[model samples]
Target: MNYVILGAGPAGVTAAETLRSVDSQASITLVGGEPEPPYSRMALPYLIYGKIDEGGTYLRQDPTHYDQQRIRYVTGRCGGIDSRAKELYLSGGEVIPYDKMLIATGANPIMPPIPGAHLEGVETCWTLEDARHILKLAEKGSPVVLVGAGFIGSIILEALYLRGCDITVVELAPRMVARMMDETAGGMLGRWCEAKGVRVLTNTRVTNIESGPEGGPRLSVGLSIGQRAPADLVVMAVGVRSNTGFLVGSGVKTNTGITVDDYLQTTAPDIYAAGDCCEGVDLSTGKPDMLAIQPVAVEHGRIAALNMAGHKHRHRGSLNMNVLDTIGLISSSFGLWQGAQAGQTAKVIDEGGYKYMKLEFEGDKLVGAQCVGMTDHVGMLRGLIQTGFRMGGWKDKLVASPERLREAYISVAQGGAVGGADVAARQHAACRVPWRGERSLAF
Candidate 1:
């Protein structure tokens, strides 16, 4: 068997490795557009902070990991696919044939249609080359203007702040990470950023950007609210779109991304799609979602490899999850933080101490949650929703405390909800706040 994967990201790399593990004799070729070795995009911010070099960002530490696994690495940009011929053509005139193919091209940073968007210093922090340029120019005390306060933008905020750059974030939405967090939770995060000395402009748009004669980043940004903000460096962290342009005429169904079945197989037989470039079902809404998170990307690759290797496997759906840290404050949202229309919700707000939590419930089950300034029991949030644990009488108890989530989970997992006898005592003894100082995770 021969496998050709059209991306060297986490998804593509994992698929290749999985295939190699399943069918050792099969020829696996991992094609990547970037010249660097397979690296993790999640480490880009750390790269900016000088905490790790380019080599540290690589997914594998050993230099010859791919070679050792007999995985051929090809550096070429994919132009298009010949579905009928079962071949992929590269821009440099190379034609590769495969019995099976996985398209995990992932996504690219979306550049807004602003006037000075294509200027020299106006860059999107997506690739290693972008990081190199950003580190080169983003000196200490540089005045930086960020165009979005979304996930990637918020992540870059910490790096920029740590680097001592004056960053003014302009978000069109009323709150930061509006898609991931609700108004209340996102608003708290924005305020937290502002308290850390970062200027946050919400519900604002950059109408125009004026550049200098040399095409430098001396940008004068005109806002929707009629204000001009000077920028030494302009960072466009607006959003990301699927890198599915290469599949334009390839007989693949693509809307926002490549449409696939439960097996991650595309419309064309023997061809599959995975990662950020694929549109799969969202478990939370039971509707199709892009789900461009790293964990989803990795799982997409694994499931695609299984089906490609003739081991039938199905990806039920992907979940919407995000954990963001701004300054010293951490916030997370899982499933659907805004709550379903017919679902009941519960909340606990402590603004003075900057703690907040809003738990969503669909009848007797937990559906979603939004949390800020707290990380304790966050792992349970995804579990509670994913497993559809019947909260029953425990629902009201959870609403009352919210800190007793661990005890509730243990109770539900062990069999059923416990009686009200030792509930308060269990919460006090068992539930230790899960957020252990920046060691929080969300799925």
Candidate 2:
């Protein structure tokens, strides 16, 4: 059996490994457009902050490891795919035929239409090369202008802060990470960035960019109030879109990305799609959602491999669970929030100092939750939500009383059939409050 994967990103790598595990004698070949081997896309900002060495970003095993596993990797760009011929056309005029193929092409950063965007010192931090370029420019203490206030832009702020570079963030939206979090949570994160010495300009757009008088480049950013600011280096951190251009007219149906069924199989037989370049349904909303997260990609790869290996595993769909660590501020949100649902009930608890907990419940089950500031127990909460826990008829009652809340949560975590009111009473009796009213409640 011949298995050919069209990318070297997380999804492709995992698919290759899974195939090898299931069928040892299968001939596996991984092709990548990047000259370098696979690297952690999530670790790009860490590389920029000098938190990890450059070599640490590489995801591929050493030459000896690949030799032992009998996995062949081809470094080249894929020009197009011939689904009928079962071959991939390479940029270097080479054709690789495959019996089974997995397309994990991933995504590319979206560069907006702005004048002088082709100027030097303007770049996007999507790849290792982009990170290296930004790092080299940072050493010169250049004034940096970062466009977009999404996850990438926020993390880049921390990285540039460690380098002691002057950064001015220009976001067209009123808040940062608008797609991931609500306006209230976004405001809290914005304040945290401000406290850390980042000049965040909201409702601002870059109209044009031009060469500076001396050496560096200058960007003309338009403000909502009608003003302009000069910038030296511009880093565009706008969101990314799926890379499915090569699949066009190849008989593989695609909307925003390559369309795949629950089994991860594309329109063509024996062909599959995964990672950022594929679109799947959301479990909660039952709507088609393209969640380009690493975990989702990894799971998609595993499911695709299972199906290719003649197994009966199906992808259960993905959720929008965003957990981010910006400096020391921890922020996370799962499912949908208030105002996001038309007829949902919401309960909010604000402890001040930028800490908050908001829960949106449709009935007995938790539809969504948002936790910001001092998030130590967010992992536990996120897990509960993912597992689809039902709070019975005690949801509203427990949320209203602080004492009952701990017991209700613990009961749900242990298994929904555990004792309810008795457990709540016992735990509340043992509960102790500290001077700051922030003591551990062991329920």
Candidate 3:
């Protein structure tokens, strides 16, 4: 069978490897627009921070890895797709035919329409080339203005901090990470960043940017607050949209992204979609959404590959989740962190300790949760919500003391006809926290 993946990101790479494993003799082609080998955009911040070299961003270490596996890698930008002809068209007029195809083209950063945005000092931290441009300008003590405080912006904020750049974050939302975190949790994160020497201006927008004096800063960033700040560099982390423009006229249905069914199949029978470029089902909402996260993309790739190889696999859908680290502060949200409509919510806030937790429950089952600073046992929130188990009497206890996740998990395990210390031990084993930069242990 001939299999072609129209991306070289995590989803496409994984799909190619999986197809090679499942059907050894099948022809596999992985196409990417970038000239470099398939690399993780997540690592670009680390590259800026000097933690890793450009090669470290690569998905595979060995240059001959793709050749060794017999997976053909093509470097070209996709101009369009001919779904009926089963052909992929590249911008350079090259055509590749495939029996089965997966669209994992991923997303591109959204550059907002602001005056002076096209200035040489303004850049978006989305690609390796962007990182190179940033490295040349974002020097120590340089005044840098970050235009967003979402997940990607927060990460870039930390990297810029490490590089000794004076960063002033301007976010249009009332709080940082507004999409992933609630007001209380987001406020805590903003305070944490401010405490760590980041000048955060929430509910503010970069109204305009312009070339400044030659001897000093090169850019003058005008904010909606009627003030201008001179900046040597400006990084736009506003947001991203799926790269599905090429899918237009291809007979593939798209809404925000390429819409895929539970099987990851597109409108065309042999065409499938995955990763940030596809609108897959969200476990929390039971609706399709463009979840541009790495874990989701990886899983989507594996499942889509299985079904493409004739294994008949159905995706269970990806949970809505975000785990972020701003300087030293850790914040996370799982499932529907934004409280469900008419659902019960439990909040525990400690502004002094830079800690907060909010739990959303529909009846006795955990529907969503958000946490900041208290990272030790929070993995239980994901476990509880994903398992869909009834907490019974433990629900009230959690409402009163949300930190007692270990106890709640144990109670649910024991109530499920399990007994003794064995259940407690398994509960501990099951409730692993998902904090980054720290060992994930049970509470």
Candidate 4:
């Protein structure tokens, strides 16, 4: 059997490895658009920060990892898929036939809808080439305007900060990471960033970017607030979309992304989809959703490989989770952090202290959480929500005292059915304080 994976990112690499393990004799071809070792875009910021060189961004540290696995790497973008012919067409007109195919093409960076984005000094921090461009352009004390404060944008802030660049973040949303974090949690992050000397402009847009005649640094960004800011470099980390445009004529179905079932198989048989290019079920909403996180992509690849190799496997669905660090402040949003309209909520907001936590519950069961400046008990909260266990009275106690997560967890996770009053008595007697940064409580 020949398995062809149309990406060399985390999804495609994992799928190749899993397939090789499952069906040793099967021929595997991993295709990629860029001419580089399969690397994690998530690590690009660290590369930019001089923490690691280009080699460190690679997902597989060993250069011969793929070669040792007997996986063939093809450097090309898949131009089209001829399902009937079982042939994949590459942009350079290479035709590769496959017995089974996995489309894990992933997503592409999106430039903000502003003029002059194509200027020489503007780049997106999604690929190794982009990192090289940034290294050359963003020097010490460079005036850098990052046009979004989302996950990717926030990540690169540290790198730019280390470069000693003056960063001005512009986000149309009212707060940083608005899609992942609520206003309270996000507001605290924005303020924290400000406290650390990052110029944050929330609820603002970069309406236009006028480049100088020679390009590179001599540019002006027109803002919605009636101000034009000069920028030596502009990083467009606004958003990204699945790279499924090449699948237009294919029989495979697509909404926001390629639709796949629990088996990670596409609408067409023997054709699988995964990664940012595919939309699967969300555990909380029980609806089709796309989360372009690397870990989710890895799981998708594993499941797709198992199914492709004629093994019984179904994806349990990925839960929503995001952790971000801006300046010195850390924040995370998981599950339905924005809580439903009729659900009960427990909120703790200490704006002065730069700490916040919001727990959403649906009748004694924790459903979601949003947190800022508090990392302890995050894992506990995650387990409580993911396990879908009835907290009973512990839920109310947690509502009253959000920091009693250790107590709530101990009550519910004592290895069996727990009685409420007894659990409360035990919590009152021995609930551990100093839970902040307590690693044991986290897990």
Candidate 5:
């Protein structure tokens, strides 16, 4: 069997390794667009923070990891695909034939439509090349303008902060991480950054950018609010879309991303899609949804490879989850964190203490949850929501005292027996601040 994977990121790499393990005699070829060895894009920020060197970003430490596994690693740009012929055309004029193909090409960073966006100093921190360029420009105390405060932008903020870059974040949303975090939580994060000496502007957009006059940064950024800031470097972290351009006429369907069935098989026969390039089923909504996180990508890879090897595995779909650490403040959201229709919600807010937790319930089962600073019990939230654990009587108890979540999780998720008396004592020990509840799932 000949297997060809379109990408060498987590998804494609995992698929290749799994294919080799499942069918040892099968020929596997992994193509990566970048020149560097398969490296984790998540580790790019750490590279800028000096926490790791270029070698540290590599996915496989040993040079011969691929060779030992009998996986062919090819570095080339994919020009297009011929689904009818079962061949992949490289821009360099190479055609690779395959019996089974996995499209895990991942995603490309989105560059917003702003004037002078293609200027020299403006870059997107998506690859090794971008990181190298950013490191050179975003030197210590250099003025850096970050155009988005979403997950990627917030992550890049940490590295910029550690590098001593005078950073100013401009987010078009009303709050930071608006997609993952609720208004209150997002506001808290914005305030947290400000407290840490980072200028955060919410509900703002970069209207224009031009060359600076002289003796300063090479660029001047104009804001929607009629403000001008000189920036040595502009990092566009707006967002990303699936890398599905190569599949335009490949007979594979795409809607926001490559549409794949539960088996991760694309519309084309013998062709599968995985990672950020495909829209997998969403567990919470039970619908096709795009989850670009690395965990989902890896999971998609394993399941797709198994099916490709004739194991007949089916992916149940991925739960939307994001855990972000921005400038020492930890925030996370899972499932329909914003709340479901007609869902009962409970929240504990301690802004002065920098702690908050919100639980959304759909008839006694945790459908969504959001938290900041209450990191110890976060895993439990994910567990209860992911497993669809039936809280039963504990639901009301949580509404009364959400801080005693540890007790509830131990009793239900862990299948432990804790008396009600113990629960009361733990509740009292946990927190004294009474939480507020609302029947309406209002914003």
Candidate 6:
């Protein structure tokens, strides 16, 4: 069998490896748009902070690992897909045919429509090249004006803070990471950033950017209360959009992202989609969501590959889980919060800075949870939610007594709310244990 996987990021690479494990003789061709090998996108901020060298960020396998695994690596951009011919048209005029194709094109940073955005020193931190350029600018003491206050932007703030770069974040929202956290959690993070000497301007918009004194860039930021601020370098971390332009009119259905069934199969037979370019159904809410996180993408790739390899595997979708490590502060959220209004109830326990736990319950069943600060119990709590634990008469007691949360989980598991087929299904959903018997699934 011949398999061609587009985009050599985590999802594509994992799909290739998984396919190899199932059918050792299957010819695999991995095409990457970027010239460099696959690297950790999460570590880009550290590169800017000078915490790790450029070479250290490359998350590649051994030099000859792909060769030994019989995987062909093609470094080029895929212009389009010819579903009728079962071939991928490359920008370099190469046609790669495939019996099975996996589209893991991932996402690209959304650059807002602002004047002088094309100017020098204004960049997006989406790839290693972007990180390298940002790092160079940071080393030269560039004054940065970040456009968003999302997780990536917050991490960049911390990174530049460590590097002593003058950064002014202008977020249009009222608080940082508003989509990921509640106002209370966002407030805590904002305070943390302020303490770290990072100037976070929330409820503000960047109207224009022009050349500053000494030919540097100056950003004209418009605040909600009608104000402006000027700065040098501009880093746009607005958000990301799925990379599915090349699949247009290729018979692959896409709404926000390439829509895949529970089996990860696209509208076209023998073609599958995963990662940031694919939108999966939310298990908790039963709605389609483009949750562009690394862990979810890795799992999508694995599940897609399993079904592609003739294994009866179904993707149970993803929960809205976010875990962020920013400047020694641990913030994590799973399921719904108090204000989400998902027909779910929540109980919040805020104990100063040491710990914060919020449990979201749908009647007697545990639906979701959010934990900020120290998260020693987050793993277990997340597992209980994913397994569909039912608290029944013990819901209030569990919330009242922190010590009994674990016991409540034990009772729910033993009471068959998370047993039998449900346990097997949960195991399948969490089974990142690569079928190839790999020691770890880091990729």
- The top-ranked prediction according to TM-score is 5
- Candidate 6: residue 193 lDDT (0-100): 75
Question: Model 6, 1-443: lDDT tens per residue?
Answer: 89999988888888888899889888899898898877778778888777887666765648787888899988999888888899999999999998889999999999999887888778899899898777766644557778899988887777877777777788988998888877777888887777776788888888776666665445444445566555656788999999998888899999999999988899998999989999986767778788888877888888888888888677776767888766677888776654345444445556456356667777776777766685665666666666665577677886576546766765565434555676555455446753322223110
The root-mean-square deviation over C-alpha atoms between each candidate and the true structure, in angstroms, is 5.6, 7.1, 4.3, 6.0, 6.9, 4.6
- What is the TM-score ranking, best to worst? 5, 3, 1, 4, 6, 2
lDDT of 3 by residue, 206-304 (tens): 999999877879999999999988898999999999999988799999999998988899998799999999999887888999999988888789889
lDDT of 2 by residue, 118-200 (tens): 88778899899899888877754667888898877887877887887777888988898888778888898888888887788
- For all candidates in order, the CA lDDT equals 0.86, 0.76, 0.89, 0.85, 0.90, 0.77
What does candidate 4 score in Cα RMSD to the true structure? 6.0
Q: By summed lDDT, which 10 consecutive residues of candidate 1 come out lowest?
A: 434-443
Pairs of residues at least 3 apart in sequence or in different chains that clash in candidate 2 = none
Q: Order of all candidates by lDDT, from best down to worst?
A: 5, 3, 1, 4, 6, 2
Better of 3 and 4 by TM-score: 3
Tens digit of per-residue lDDT, candidate 1, span 54-106? 99999889999999999999999998899999999999999999999999999
TM-score of each: 0.92, 0.89, 0.93, 0.91, 0.93, 0.89
lDDT of 6: 0.77
What stretches of model 5 exceed 4 Å from their correct place?
Answer: 418-443
List the candidate 1 regions with Cα displacement exceeding 4 Å: 212-217, 414-443
Reference-based TM-score, model 6? 0.89
- Give the C-alpha lDDT of model 2: 0.76
